[model samples]
Target: MGPTREQFIQYAPAALAVAAAAAGPWSAIAAGAAGAGAWAISVSAPALRSLIACGITATGCGIAAHQVLASGMNPLFALGLAVPAGAAALAHHRNLAGELLPALPATTTAAAGAGQSSQAQVITAYWMEFISGPTQTEGRKLIQAGAVLAHLGLDVGDEHMSFTGIITLPQGQQVRVKPADIASVYGIPASQVEMGDPKHYAPNALPVTVHLRKAPEQPQIAAGIPTTVEELWAAHVAIPDGAMPGTALTLTRYDGPLDWEGIATRERKAIGAVNLQDLAGNLDLSSIQIALAPTDKPSQMGVRVMKEHALMHGTMLSDVVDELAMDSRGYVRLGTYIDANAALVPLAQPGSGARHLYLVGGSRSGKSGILEQILLSAHKSRIAVILASPQAGTIAGAGLAAHCGDGLDEAMGALRLAYAVMLDREARYRTPRFPFTDPLIEFILDEAHMLLLASSQYHLEAKAIVEQLTRRSLKRGIGVVLATQTPLAEDLGNSTVIRSQLLIGGGAVFLRCAKGQGSLVGTNAVEGAEGIDLSMIPPQWPGQYAKIADRDMSGLDTEAAARPEDGTFGLGYLLTPGSQAVQFRSLHLDVAPVSLAGSLPPVAVEDCEAWRHREAIMRTPMVDQRGKNLIGSLADLLTKAEQGPPSAAQQGQPAGPQQAQAHPASSAGSAGGDARELLKPRILELLRSGSSPMTAETIARKLGTSVKHVRPRLSELKGRDEVINENTLWRAA
Candidate 1:
C-alpha cells in the first residue's frame, strides 16, 4: 500500500541535484553530495531519519557556500535543494493511513432537540428497569438511585419530567406506575383525592425506605437494642419491673426496658386506645430503674396526660368550700388534692381545724403561688384577707381588706388591729348574750422572719404580735399563714414560741431543701420522709417538696416532732393524716401581671360582693354605745399595759441618756442623723423630679424606710406647707 524505504533513498539524491541546479551548478553538485550522504545514513539507520535530514541540509549549505565562493554564486540558493529532498522522503512515508484511522466517521450528529429526547429515553428505560421488577432488589436499587439524585437536588420524574412517579400495588402485584393512576388504581374515590404527599400514599411509597418503617415485623423488645416505646407497646410486650404500666418503655440492645428518650409524656397506648391517632410513636427511649419516674434524669414518668375537668380544673380552693358547705364565718378553703386521673379529690372535711399554716420554700418555689391561691380562695368563700409584706408593691393590686406596708410601724398597726379583733371575739365567746358572726379574717404575713427579727425598736412589738396571734387568733376565727425562706429557729429570734403553735394544730409544707429545720414544723412536717432521692430532681421543678402536712393525720403522733430530714431540693411530699405520704407535682397557676396600674383584678366573681360587704362592715367602727366603750376600753388597756418606759418623743422632751439608749429607733436616728437628713433631701428630689404626685409608699421605698415611719415625717413636711398630701399622694407645695 506504500513505497519502501529503499525507494525513498534512491530518489532523494537525484531529486536534490535537480532542485539545486536551479540555483547554480556548484550548488547542484554540492547538494547532490549532501543528498547522497543523507540517503546512506537513512538507509543504514532508519531510526535516525529526522537527524539525517537535518544534517544533510546543513552539510549542503556548507558545501554550497564553498562551491559558490569558488564560483562567485549566492549560498542562499542551496536551501531550495533541501526542500525537494524533504518532499521525496515524505512520499515514501507509509504511516498516513494509521494516523487518519482514528478520524474516520463512526456516528452521525443529531439536532439539539432530537438529541435531548434520545437521552431522556435512555434514562427512562434505565429507571423503569430498576423499579418495575417484582423483587425488592431492583426496588431497593431504584430507591438508592432516587436518594442519590435527591441529594444532588434532582428527583426522578414521570414521562413528562414534571411530577415524580409512584411505585404502587395494582391487582396485588407491585408495579411501578405513573402518579396519575395512584387514586384509581388504589380504589380511592376521585373526589377524595388529596394533594401531593398525603398520609395515604401508594403501597410502595417513599416512606418505606426508613429502616423502622420498612415493613411490619414480629414485635420483639431486646435490651440495649434502642427501640422506641411505641414499638414496645405495639408488640404488647410485658412491662419490666421497676416501671409502671401506662408508661412508655423502650428496649435497649440488652433485654431490659428503658424510658424512651425525648418522650416527655406517656400518651401512646395499645392499638385500641382513643388517643391512638395522636401518639408520638417515633421517639427512641432508654431503660428506667424505679417504678416511679425519676425527675432529674430523662424519665418518661415526668409527663402526665391532662384529662378534662368540669369546674376550675375541679381543684380550685372554692370547689372544696362548696363541696363541704363550710360556714363562711369560720372556714376558708385551702388547696385541693389531685388524683391520678387528674380529678380533684375532696379533702377529709371542709374546715380541717381552720388552723394556721406555715409555708416555707426557697426562691421561686411556688410560695407566692400558694399564697395567691389562699387569698383568692378566701375571697371566693366570702372571707376577708389581710396581706402584709415589706414591699407594698408586691400586693399593690391585690383586692383585700387591707395591705400593710413592710415597715415595722405598719406591720405593728395591722397586728394591733388583729389582736383587737381577737379580743372582741374572745369577749363574745365569753359572753352568753352576744353571738359571734364575723366572717373569718385571714392574716397572711409574707417574709415573717424579717419582720420578727429586726434589730430595731419594733422587734419587741413584732414578738408581741406573734405571741398574741398564736395564742388567741385561732379561737377568734383569725387564720394566719406565716411564710418565709429560712425557717431556722435562730431566724425566728425571741418569737420561737410560735413554733410550738405551728406544730400543734397547724399545717406545713417543707419544700426541697438541703436539710430540714426540725424545730420549725416539728416531726410531722417530714416524718417517714425517707428514701427520697435528691439526684432525681431537675432545675425546672423548683417547687418540689419532700413532705406536705395534709389537713388530717390519723396515725401520726402530734407530740413527736419530725426528725431533721434531708433530701433533694424541690421534690414535694404530701402527708395526709393517718395515710401514707403521696408524692405530687406542684400546682401551676396562670400568670398574673405583677404591676399596679389600673383596676385591681379579683380572683372569682360569683361570691366577691358578699365577701366585700362582710369585710366593709368589720372595718367600720360600731356606732352603738357598747361597741364604742369596748373599743375605748381595749385601746386603754393595751396602751396602759406597756412595760418599757416612753421614749423622749412620747414624753415631749429631749432624749435623756437612758431614754436615748432604751429606744433603738432613737439611738439609730441619733447615730445617723446626718444620714437621715440626707434621706429627706433625696425624698424632696424624687418629688420634684416626678411630674405626678408620688404615694407615701413610693417615697418610703426611695428613702429605704418603712411607709409607717415615713408617713409621720411626710405629715410633718405637710404641716410645714413644704408638701401637699393629695389623696394618698404627696407633692411639692
Candidate 2:
C-alpha cells in the first residue's frame, strides 16, 4: 500500500531537513535544527508519529544517504544501521503469526547494482551500434528490428521487447525473421505477380507453348509513308531480307478511299514537274542516266512512278528523262519545292560539298550582304575567319574585327599565322592512335581580289600562300570563301581554281568567267546565261544567285532549304534580306601641306647625315674587273686639285709635241672644271633650301651659273630626280 497523505504531512519537516542538508552547508544546519524540533514534537505523540514518520523518515534517510555517498562516504553503512534498526523495532511490536511483514525492500542497493549493469550494457551497445550500423555495413540492411516492430506487428505493453525473433528450421539452424503477417503469410494478388506460366497453381507449366490453332499473320509496313528508289534499292538489293518478294507485299489500311489526285499533285510538286525540261538539259548523262521501265512490282519501281506522275502534272518529261539514264549511283530526293517563307529552311542546308567559293557582283548587286550572311553563318559555327580589307571599319561589327588587320601585309600575316596554328594543332595529334577532331576552319576573304591586286608585286608569295591553303588545308578542314565586285581572271587565277569553286554571281563577266571555265553547265546557266551581262546588273537586287552541284535539282532544293538567315551561303549564293544594312566607317588619313623653309639645323640633320654616310659607303666603287682604280683615281684627282697642283708624273706623262702643247692649258682648265662641277650641286641645294620657290634663272644666278648652261643642267637634274615644280616654281631636284 502507498503511504497516506497524513503520514506524508507528519514527516514533512524531517523530509525537508534531509533535502536541505543534501543541497548546501548553510541549509544543512537550518534543516538539522528544524528536524530536531520536529523530532521533539514527535516525542509528545511518539506512538502515532513514529508509525507515520517511519515511512517519511525512510525517504529522508535515502536523500541524506545520497549526500554522504556523493562525498565518498559509504552509503551502505548509513542505510544498514538506520533502515534495519527501524524495521527490526517495528517487526518486534508486530504480530508475526499468519501475517506478511510490512517492511521496506532493499531496493536502493538492488537499484544501484541493476542501474550500473544496465548503463554498462547501454554504453557497449552504443559503441557496437555506431560501428555496425554506420561504418562497416556495405549496403543497407534488408530488415531492421525497429522498422519491423513499427510496420509489421501489433504493439505490446513491454517497452524493451522487439517485434522480432528467429525461426528455427527442421535442421535446427536459426534464421532471423521479423513476424510480418502481411509479407510472410499473404501472397500478392495474381494479377500483381509476374509468373511465367499460362495456368495458375500448375507446377508443370510449360516454359513456352505452341498452340495448334491457326493465327493471322502480320501485314507489311512499306504500304504507308513515302519511299524512293534509293531507299527501295537499298532495302531490296543491298540488304539480304530487304529484297524478298514475298515480304515486299504492302498492305495499306486506310480510313476511306485514297485521294489519287492529291497524291499525284504532291508527287508532281516533289519531282518539280514544271522544271523537268530544265532538269533534262542540265542532267549529266555521262554520270547519271534516267529512263522508265515497267515492272509487275510497282513498289520495286519506286521513284519511277513518282517521276512519271510529276512529269504528267507540270514537269516536262525531258527534265528527268536524262536522270533515268544512270544505273550505278544511288540517288534520293529528300524534299521538293522551295520554301522561301520557312525560317529554318535556309539553316537546314549548307553549301554543296565544295571547298572554294567565288562570289562576284557589282555594287548593290547584294554581293557584300550575301558575303556577310555566309560569314555570319560560318562564324556562328566557330569557323576561324581571316578577313583582308583596305577599307577600314567595313566589316567592324561582323565578329571578324579582331581577325582583320590594317592592310594587305597585315592581313596576309594574320592568315598565315592562323594557318600555322591550325597546322600545329593538327601535328600535335599526329600519333598513330590519336587523331585531329577539329572541324574545317573556313577563311572568308571579302574583297579577296583586292588583296591579289594589292600584292601583285609580291605575286609569287601571295600565290604560294593561297595555293598552299587551297591544296593542303582541305583535308585539315580549312576552306576559303572569296568575294569580289569583279571576276577578273588574273585576280582569281586561271580558270582551274575558279572552276573548282562553288561559283555565285551575276553579270556577263561573272557568267563568262564561269561559262568560259566550264562551271556553268545546266539550263539555268543557259537561259539566264545569256542575260548575265555585267553592264545590265541592277543595283536594287543584291541577292540573285546561280547554284551548281554534282547532285540533281532535288539536292539544290534541299541545300536552299538548309541555309540560315544569319548563316553564310557558299560562293555564288547571293543573300537577300528585307531591310537596309548599316555599314561601319573608319577614320581616313590626313595629309599635311609641304613647307618651304630654311635648311634643317645641323643637329637636327644628324640622322640624315648618318643616312648619307651609309649611302656613300654603300655607293663606294671597288676595283673593276680589269683591276683599274675606279673610285681611287677620282679621289686622288680631287685631292690634287684641292692642293692647287698636278704632281711630276701627271706633268711628264703627256709630252708628245701635240700633247705637250695641249698639256698645260688642259691641266689648268680641267682643275677649274672639276672644282666647279663638284661645287654646283651644293650651290643648287642651298638655293632650294630658302623660303621662296626658285626658278632655274634665280638658282643659276645664286650659284654663279651662266643662264644658258644653268637651264640644261636644271633640266638634267629635274629629269633625273623628283623636283618640286609648284606653280612652275622650282625648289630642288
Candidate 3:
C-alpha cells in the first residue's frame, strides 16, 4: 500500500540524515529531506510539492548556516554536510527508488598502433560488437564499412570479426566497432559492408591488382623508327637485370634502369636481325602518346618502368588505352616505314604518298561499311573509282553501285579499261618529257571473295591481275581497294602481298588472323578485353572501325576522339594528309543477284507452229515401218496439198466410196489387225523428233490419215516409252 503523509513524515528524519552523509551539510540535508516529502504529496497533488522542494533547499541552506554560527559549529563541516543532504533530498523529492549512483570515472585516451599487434586488438574489439548487434541497421553499417575498406585496398580477412576498429563515421565522428557488429545490427551479411580502405590489403588479395601484374606492356611501335631483326634481338638481351624481356612491367615505380643492351637485342630479333638504323627507319611511332603510371602496384610495374625511357615511351599496359584507340578510329592502323631499297616499296605510294589499301572482315562485321568509308574518302579526293560486285543487287542503290561490275571477268575488264583510259589520257598530255596531273583512279572490289572463289577461273585471273597491278600500278597513280570476308593469306596467293596491301582489319576472325602475323596494333590501343562483346557486333556505326591508319604520319591509331552521340566521329575518323579528315559511314546497299556467264535466245512464231504440229503427230501411238514411211511421205503430200496441187473436186482427188468408207491400210501388206499398228510407227517417229504438241486432228493431217485412226495410235504410242505429252506439248522422253 502507498504510504500516508504521517507515515512519510515518520521517515523524514532518517532520509535527512542519509542525505547529510551523502552531501555533507546537515541543514542542506534537512532541506532536501523536506523537499522529498513535499514531492511525494505533490505526486498526489502537483503544484504544492513542486514548490516545496525549491523552497526547502534554499531555506534549509540559509538556516543551516545560521545554526552553525549560533551553535559555534565549523562552517566547512556545515557546508560539507549540506552537500550530500541536498542531493538526498532532491532524490527523495524526485521519487527515485534505488540508492543514488556514483560519479563517472575519468577515461584514458591513447593513439591506436599499427601492424600485427594493433591488428589483434582491433580484431578482438570487432568480435565484441559483431556478437552484440543483430539488427538491420547494424548490418547496413557493416556493409558500408566493408565497401570503404575495399576502396582503400584493404583485405578484411575471411573472419567475420576481423574488421573491428574505429571507423570514421558521418560528421567526422569515429565509432569504434566491429564489421560483424554493424552487419548483425543492420541485419545483413558482412560482404555487404562497403566501407574501409581498399589498399590496405596485400597484393595477392586483389584480383584487379593481380591481373594488372600479369598483363604485359607492349613495346613502343613507332612510325619511321629505324629497327631491324638484329635490333629486336639486342633489345631482348638488353632487358634489365631483374626483369625478363617479356615479363610484365608497370610505370608506377620504374625508373630508367632497363638493361639497354638486352632491350636492343630484343628489338633486333623482333625485326629479323636487320640493321638497327634500318629497323628504326621502318618503325613509325607518330600518333602515340606515352602515359605515366598512376599507381605503385607491382602489376603496374612493367608499364610504369617502360614508360620512363624514350625507347619505351609508347608502350602501355592498360586495355582502356587500346579500346580508346580502336573506338576512336573505325579500324586499327599500323605504321610501317617504307624502305626505298625494299622490293615491296613499289606496291605503295613512294614516301607515304597515297597507298592502296585492302580490308578484310567476316560477314556482318562491317567489312562493307569500312570499305564504303574508304571509298568515300577517296572520292572526296577526286579519285576515280571502278567498283565490281558479282552479287548484283546486293550492293545496288548504295553510292558504290556506280563502281559495281557484272561478273569477275567484267570487273577485271572494267578495271583494265579504266587503267587503259587513264593511260590514254596520260599519254595524250603527259610523256616522260612533259608531266601532267590527272585524277587518280582507284578500283574498289566489294565481296572480293567472289573473285577469289576456287570454282571460278576468272577469280584466279583476277588475282593475278590484281597482284601485278598492286606491284606496279602505284607509279601510274592507280590504287586498288579490295575488301573480303576472308583473311586467309594463302587464299590471296602471297603473304607478302597481303601484308603489303592490308591497311585495316575488323571482326574476330580477321583480328585473330592479323594477330597471328604480329600485324595488329597493340592491346594498349584497344578498350579492355571486357569492353567488346565476343558473340555479335552491334549495329553499324557510320565510321566505327577496329583500326585506322594515319595517312600523313604513316602510323596506326585505334579509335577516334570525337563522341558518337554528337554525330561527329560516331565510328571513328581517318586523318588524311593536310587538313583533310573523313568520318566513316556505312553503306546501305540492297542484295544483288548472282551473275551468270551467258544469256538465252528468244523463240519465233513459225518455229512454234512447226514444233506444235510435230509434237501432235508424235503423241499418237502407231507401228509398222511401212506405215511410218507412208506418214513420212504424207509430210511431202501435205506441203503439196497446201500449195494446191489438186483441187478438192478434181478427178485424181475424187472421193471414192470405198476410200472414204474403209480406213487406209499400208501397201506393206499388214491387214486390219496389224493396220492399226502401222499408224503407231509413223506417230512414234514424228513424236521422237520432239517437235511440238498437237491434237489428234493436227496429227491426222500431218500423217495423211483420218482422226479416228490416229487417235487410237496416239494413245498406244503414249503407253509405250516412245513419247511424253506435257502441257499438251508432245516430245520424246
Candidate 4:
C-alpha cells in the first residue's frame, strides 16, 4: 500500500531539509538538526551500531557547520564527510532491529496482556516477533542461546493451545540451553519446558518440533501409581535442569528406553530440581525405585514404579522358598527386583547342560552372601554339594555341604571330584542326563579366583581342571558355582571362552566391579548379563542395615563398625523379569544361614569319575564334617549321627554334612595326637602373614584343614605365646 497522507506530510520536513543542505551552510546545519530529530523519533531501542552511525553523522554536520561559518570553508567540501556518513545511517536504518518492533499498543491492550499468565505473554510475544522477521543475527547468538524460539510462532491457550513451533536444531549440536533461560526470556517457567526429539532436518539446519504445553496449576503425581518420566513430564512435572551443574543424569527417557536398560542408571536426578519429599509426600527415597517399568497401559509405554523397592527393605530366602518343591529345583532365588520381580538364576536348565553360577564382586559386593544362598538352596533342594571356600562359611556354618574343603589344594580336589562325578555319570549312562529335579551334584568355590591366580604354583593345573569342567561337563549331572572379587581375564580360568561356557548354562551375577579393570565388564561375564551402570549404585545400599558394633566385649574388636569396609553389598544387578533384568538386593539371612544346609551324601573322590581316571586322586580324601566318609572309623560317628546333632565336643566340625565322619585327629590311636601337633606351624604361618586377627575357621582354610585341627593348635599356640585369641579372631603374638 502507498504511504498514508499523514506519514507523507511528516516525512516532507526531513526531505526538504536534506535538499536545502546542498544549497547553503545554514541549510546543511538545518539538515543535521532535522536528521538527528528524525532519528530520535523513528528508532526505539536501536542497536549500538546504528546509534553510533546516527551520532557520528550528526556530529560530523556540526563540525562542517563550525568550519564553514567561522573559517569560510567551501560548504561542499566541509559537508562532504557529513553527506557520506548520513548515507551510511540511512543504510543501517532500513535493516535496524528496532524498526521491526511494533508501535506501543493502547493502554487497555497493554493491561490485558500484562494480566495474562506467563504462558500467554510468551506466546503472544513469540507470534509478534516471528511475523516481523527471523530473530537470528550474524553471530548466531540467538540460536545458540535458544532465543530463536522468540521468532517461532507460539500459541498457548488451555490444553488446546500449547506452545508449538518448528525450531532449528543443527546437526551434532547438543542443547546446552537451560530451561531457566526460557522462563526469564519468554515468561515461561523452567518446569513447563518440554522438548520433542528432532526428526526431519533442512540442508542448513535440523528442524525440531517443539511443544511447550501449559504446566498444571499445581504439580500432581499419581498416588501409588506408576508413571513414566515422559508421561510425568507430559503432565507437567518439574523439568530436569541439565544445564545446572551436578544435575545431569547419564540415562534419560529421551536417550533410550528405560525398561531394557540396566537399573544402575537411576533417574532420581531426572526431576531432581523439585523437592522429592514434596513430590512423593515421603521423606525416604532410598527404597523408592524411579526406573522405567511397564505400567497398566503397556501399549502406551507406561512405567513401573515401586515405593520402598522390594529389595531395599530386602526379603529373606525363607520368604520365597517353596518347601514342597525344594526336593529338586533348578532356579535359585538370589533376591527381589526393585519392581518386586524375583531375581532367578538357573542352576541347571531343563534341556541344556547343568549351568554353573559364576558370581563376581569387588570387596563388599555380597559375593559371599550369594554363595551362601546357593548352598542353602542346594541343600533345601536335596542336591549333593561339594564346597571349597577360604572361610568356608565358618561364621555362617558350612554344615550344608556333603564334602567341605578350603584353600587351593582343597578347591582343586573338590573340582576334580565333581568333574569325576560328572564323567562317571556320563560313563555309566551314555544317555543325556537331564538337568535339575534329578540327583545333582554341585561344586561351589566361594573365592575360586584365589585358586586360579597367576602367582599360584597350582594356577595352570587348577585353570585346566576348571576349564575342562566348564566345557566338557555340559549335560552332566554336576555343575560348578564359584564367587570371587577378582574376575579379570587372568583370574578367569583360560580367559573368556572358558568363562563363556561356564556361564552358558546359568547367567552370571555382577556386583560392584573393581576399578582400573573396566575390561572385566566387557568380558563374557558382563556380556551374558545386560549392560548395567555400576556407578549408579552407591558404595553400598546406604539405606537401613543392621547397625554394627552391637557388642563391645573386653577382648572384642570395636574399631570395625559398619560393613567390613566401605564396600558395597546386598544391592546389585541380577537377570530377572524374563530377558530384561533389574537391580536387586540379595536376600538377607534373618535366621542362621547354617539351617539352610542340605542332607545330601558326600560325592567323595572314591565315588567320582576322578577316582576312575586317576585312582591316585584318592590320596586326597573327602574330609566330610558329618563323619560319613571317615578313613579310619565310623562307629562313634554312627552313634552321633543317630543323635541328630553334633555334641559340644565336636562343634568345631563343619555343619550339615550327610553320613557322619569321625575326626581322624580326634581319634584315640590313629595318629590323632600327632596330627593336632603337626597343624600348629601351618596355623601360625597363616596368622603371621595376616595383618588382622582371623577366626580359627579362616586359619583352617589357609592350612587346608578342619576347624578342629585349627582350634586345638591355636589354643596350644596361645599357650606357647605364639598366637592370641580375641573372641572369634586368632592372631600371631
Off by over 4 Å in 4: 1-228, 231-310, 323-329, 350-353, 390-395, 433-438, 517-525, 528-536, 542-568, 576-578, 596-615, 618-733
Model 1 poorest ten-residue lDDT run: 148-157
Report the Cα RMSD per candidate. Answer: 31.3, 38.2, 30.2, 23.0
lDDT of 1 by residue, 251-363 (tens): 32222233213233345432111111122222222110211223333324332222111111223232233432234344333333323322122111233324677666666
lDDT (0 to 1) per candidate: 0.42, 0.34, 0.37, 0.50
Best candidate according to lDDT? 4
TM-score of each: 0.36, 0.26, 0.31, 0.42
**Candidate 3 lDDT, tens digit per residue, 1-733?**
9876544643564454544334434456466557665675553443344335544554555556556766887768666645644564555444422111111122212222344443333322332233322223322333333212221132332122222223333432223344444455334444444333324522222222101011234679887543543343235423342222433222233222331111222222221211211222222211111111112232221121121122211111121122211111223322111110100111124323225665555544445544444444343334455676555644432353234455655555454443333333322322222122544456666666665665554544455446545654454555666666544454464334543543321111121122233222233111112111112222322222322221224454344442222221112122222211121222221112111101321111122222234322222212122113221222332243344423324523544656544535432223465766777777777666523344465566566566777766666777886766543334455
Clashes of 3: 185
Global CA lDDT computed for model 3 = 0.37
lDDT of 2 by residue, 11-32 (tens): 5444453444354334445445
Backbone clashes, each candidate = 33, 32, 185, 15
Top-down TM-score ranking = 4, 1, 3, 2
Candidate 2 accuracy as lDDT: 0.34
What does the lDDT read for residue 243 in candidate 2?
Answer: 20
**Ranked by lDDT, top first:** 4, 1, 3, 2
Which stretches of model 1 miss by more than 4 angstroms? 1-353, 431-435, 454-457, 494-496, 512-525, 528-537, 541-571, 574-581, 591-636, 641-645, 648-733
Worst 10 residues of 3 by lDDT: 336-345
**Residue 168 of candidate 4: its Cα lDDT?**
38
